[model samples]
Target: MLKTVRSVSIADYAKSGVLILPLLSSRKRKAEERRGKTVRKKGQERLLQGNEAIVEGALRAGCRFFAGYPITPATEISELLSVRLPKVDGTFIQMEDEIASLGAVIGASLAGVKSMTATSGPGFSLMQENLGFACIAEVPCVVVNVMRGGPSTGLPTSPSQSDVMQARWGTHGDHPMIVLCPSTIRECYDLTIKAFNLSEKYRNPVILLVDEVIAHMREKIILDGDKPIDIFTRVKPTVPPEWYIPYEDTPTGIPAMADFGEGYRYHVTGLTHDTRGFPTSRPDEVDAFIRRLFRKISQNFTDMQMGEVFQTEDAEVAVIAYGCVARSAKRAVIDARERGIRAGLLKLNTIWPFMRTQVEKILHTSGCVIVPEMNMGQISREVKRVNKGTAKVFTINKVDGTIITPQEILGKIREVC
Candidate 1:
């Protein structure tokens, strides 16, 4: 006997606290079948590219503007947005390069439209200047980097975790940034949506860390309209239009954004600014503005540390990984369990803000932590910093353009354990 999934109404989502929508409706009796089922009302479940998934997620998140240059493994995002944006009454533009792409996205975001841009490592390198500009200006937008090998076009078609550090501090100077790395294909679809929400809520740019392997790998993602997705619009000030100070916060660290045509004559600039959004050369004003910008993100660390734990309870060894490496680490944990190694996996959906407290809790119960990344060990250093000498932090780093396999991670675990 085949059991069918019950389709629920949109209002029912809030009432039951569980959203039952059609993803890919499966005929099988397995728990992991959600990714394979396609609910027709929401969207059909077919083979979707990672870049396309990002495009869909952005659109669903109320992103009305997209600007980007076509780059390897991430071109599909721009290609899809070019056709989809106009149909949805949104705007899409192909810029001269990644720098212009980010410039356009920031301008549109300032105009009260949720905007996004997609690129790979080389393009990402060029966009850093404008990324810094968006940070200083407190612009809300999403940037998806389908990461390939780095260090000046190291490997275009290959997957690499080389940009993990770049996503955090590449823009230079003192700034707080939110970076989310998706391990699963489903997360590619889901986290892209969340990226926009966080960007809008915090009034900062959110980077979607997509590696090349996950970006190109075709996955059967179940699209369901019934899923209760949080779409956060930019915070609007309750103060009167004339009385509104754009840079002033409302206790929640987020300053209300005034769009370009909103009649709120606020000025925004790359240089240090003040409460009225005007540039100031005063030392106190510059100091206050920079600190507030960092606090807007650092203060929300509680909301930003999104992660998944696999068999962490009573584990002696833990595997910490993110992005495509997480998928491999999951299998390694299972294999280690069968061998009586008591290995666990901490898969990070939020890579930035480092989640040091949560990691400390895990380290208190574990003997060793293994960090497997596709680069020359970026996150392992963070793991070490968080571990604080409580546990031995070992790293398995590979930058040969291929994903770190489960066997590779298992070998590292064996050596460390």
Candidate 2:
């Protein structure tokens, strides 16, 4: 029997400090059964790990170069690419280390090849400096960080969401960053393609952040191989080689990129450069360069800051979550509704360049908002910042190399309501 939320009452839960678990109604049971049944799509449906789906997405998105070091949890990405890239006439290299891996990827992209690299926590840390170089150079490339428990290879194979802050701040200085989180196997494939498109369109390094759970989890998904997918490539300079300016700012703030050996001699550097790509120390030139990078992304928030809202139309309470933990949050929301609570959920797809406007609206509307993550309040902090006391903010943080359960989130909802 199903019960609508708060039907069991705060007083009832308070007496025992436990939410009464209700059996799913027949309708609910049928829905679960439908999800469990395998698809019968011919030549399209197959079981794949999240990491493997990413490789497929990359190939489909026209990724031709992959240079990476083998690291636990992320090793499959490199391993699979090595086999797949060759079949497609693409290039793949096992670099000496993470730093060199990104360096190679940067070089490949500069030569007009779509390139990428994958790494775990420690390797991600090592790539930070090189990643900063990519940002300043405005190189179009992709970096996949398969997060694992860590401070110093803390738990190489265990799951953890502690890298949320690191992904945004890992590189020394602030330029523009795009970090995406995928919660499902299908998203792993779709977002990887989207990541490549965004990188080429913006001529910037894009990070695809995947934790252990999603990276290794296996599920049935349709590859959609026959679908006509939209792909974006960097705009190349049509001007004569002698007239090309590699870093010239445009109305969209994205400059036309030229391949290194395309007969256009342009300097690429970590130093602040102007239109000619030559290092400039002039105050005005540096200011324009930095502002242009920020403008290209910030001005395009609608296309960049992506998220999904569930049951929020009439919701009085909401749960904000992302990555694998979002699955749990969704289940909790449905259960809350069954128990007669008007609860909702918001799952963030873009981690950085936070979705502030949508979050602010939810904060203003909901009586209370709960943010549950694998890290200790990393995203919750952002929610609270946007809150401004519009709604009471609560957090359910877990960082013990384990996941936060739906039951755990329900308990918090029960207590708060």
Candidate 3:
């Protein structure tokens, strides 16, 4: 029996008296295939730019407010926020400069918003005063410093890892700091969320030290759905608004923020203050307040140490690096391994409050270490300090307002080997 299976358009069958079609058109089949691709199943892949993914991460992290000034290397962050924030029912404001940018972020955080600002080297320098304010007032916010070369107004278009120390000590005296560095586009997405969580958790500024190279590089990043991200909001005050002392510390360093329209009355100052938030002239009170701010970070040191180890389990030589510099070191490690050398990398994603214990263990076990940075031996000192004269530590430094290429690192590794 050779009876043909007929396919007919329902509309044509309904409107006309003829049995019209035997098969669907290629155009119709192609449309169906296109629709199927768009209907995402349990798992699908995506390619994202480093900056675009950061914007997506910020929105997912409950960051409702952003204020920033335009600066090269990090301007994409602000541009992305401008378009994305409005769609998410959030607010984005462009301030006159980086100083005002951080000032607005602190103010917004105080008004019960998850806030952020982004800048490059020069703007980062300008934001220091307000950064100190956020530290003193215990305001939760994120600052992205897409680093460029510089002492003052240096290379704005190029990449550099020169801001590593600045992220920790830039703001000034006795204030707690947390800085995260990302080596890949995927990490750029993931760490932004983590930065927000740390800021809100500890009631301090969390810096994402991105470099110009990573900020501009495009890559394939899988946005995973199976693993849900853990997001943390600041601990709210248990006491009523009338009884709430804004600067009062709970088990956590953070204090619950009462919106200005609310009836709660509290003061905030860059000057040393008390639980009531009023400025204090007493030296002991100032000392105690500063100590509390720093202790909040030091006490929870375990939570902040983040790094990646590749082939380090049984390696004789280890390369230590962060930011884009780690990218070169990674390839160098691969080359060294192929040549019958036991080489590995300790890639740091968290730069500040240097992971001393982690570095110490590697240094004690490993025969030698190589530190590659875009600046002149900033992190090498920290590595040597942790090594404590146990390991032969070598440094490969570059400060020509450019990235250290993989070949350069390989040459150094060969020389040392």
Candidate 4:
């Protein structure tokens, strides 16, 4: 015998205060069986931990080389890829340390392989110099930072969003990179794919930021079986090998990348370089090179920005959040709506490039914007900067290795409303 409930109410579930296991109907059971087959055959639906999903997503995105050091809250990604990459004829190397891990990934990417490395806060900090090198050299690779507490190995197993600012500016010098934050297991998978795509498309490093909560949480995800994921490979140089200039300017501010041993031999160094890839001390050449790197990302801001809006069409109070904290803000928004508060949520999927246009619009239209982060006001500072006195910006932050609850966000909404 099988049974099904049409829907479950949050109120009822809260009143019960215990986990309820659902009974599936016969039709639902058969559908689930079909999904299981689809998952096995086409690799669509499955219960995946966030870190595991990232590995699958990277492989699907054509990540043929992985070089990473073991770091908690992210080591599982390297562990899984170590076994899986060989089966796909890809290469995986466990480097001696995070610096070596990113260094190896940068080398792999320049050799024309789509590559990645994963780490947590401490390891992420260790990779900064190499990360900057990859950026200045315009090598495409993905970096996954499953954030745990830190300024110095604060908490390993616990979740934190303390690395939000670091992801944007950990590396020294002026450079451009993309950083995406995922709040759910599904986004953990999908954004990993997106991170690689952006890195390839833009010829720069891309950071996928997830906290311990999302990285360790397991969830059922229904991957699309009918449609295949779109993967983007870096644009190869069209010039003849004799005339090929690795850093030649293009309309998109992205140069056509030439792979090593691909009939093109070009120099790559961290120094400011010219079109021919030689270190340039010339003021004009250095200025142009730096601007081009910044322009590639700044000019294509529309393409880089990704976010979600809920109940904001007529909201007077908006909640701006990202990472696992966004999950609580979403629930708080829903509860606020039920209580007749015109509240809404602006969930940032792409944290860097900072959704300025969207944030500006919210600042102008809404009476107040609430920012709740797991860190001590990292993103809230950005929100306030964009607000510029147009609207009130309230911050509710926590960094005690604990997640902010829905009730806490709701309370802030109530206060502001």
Which of the numbered candidates is closest to the native, going by highest TM-score?
A: 4
Show the colliding residue pairs in model 1: 23-37, 23-39, 24-37, 24-38, 25-37, 25-38
Per-residue lDDT over 78-175 for candidate 3, one digit per residue giving the tens place of the 0 to 100 score: 99899889998899999999999999999989888999999999999999889988888888899999999999999877889899889889987877
Point out the worst 10-residue segment of candidate 4 by lDDT. 1-10
The residue-by-residue lDDT of candidate 2 on 1-417, one tens digit each, is 011233233343232212223346667656764886322344566678999999999999999999999999999999999999999999999989999999999999999999999999999999999899999999989999999888897887888888888988899876889999988888899889989999999888999999899999887777876557889999999999998878888889998999988898889999988888899999999999999999998888778777777778788889988888887887787789889888888888899889898889888888699999988789999999888888999999888999889899988877898
TM-score of 4: 0.91
What lDDT does model 1 reach? Answer: 0.82
Model 3 stretches astray by more than 4 angstroms: 1-44, 225-227, 249-251
Candidate 1: stretches off by over 4 Å: 1-43, 226-228
Distance from true location, Cα of 78 in model 4, Å:
0.9
Better of 2 and 3 by TM-score: 2
What's the lDDT for residue 19 in model 1? 28
Candidate 4's residue-wise lDDT over 263-370, tens digit each?
A: 898899998899899999999999999999999999998887888776787889999888888888878887887899998888888999789998888888897999
For model 1, residues 1-417, the per-residue Cα lDDT tens digits are: 111112223243122212245444344423444665423433355567778778878888898999999898899888889999999999999999999999999999888889999999999999999999989888998999989887997887899989989999999899888999886667788888889888888888999999988888777666655566678898777777899988884566678887888788888988778888887899988887888888878878887778877778867998888888887887787778778888887888898978787678778888788888888889888888777788887888897878899999888878877
How much is the lDDT of residue 309 in candidate 1? 78
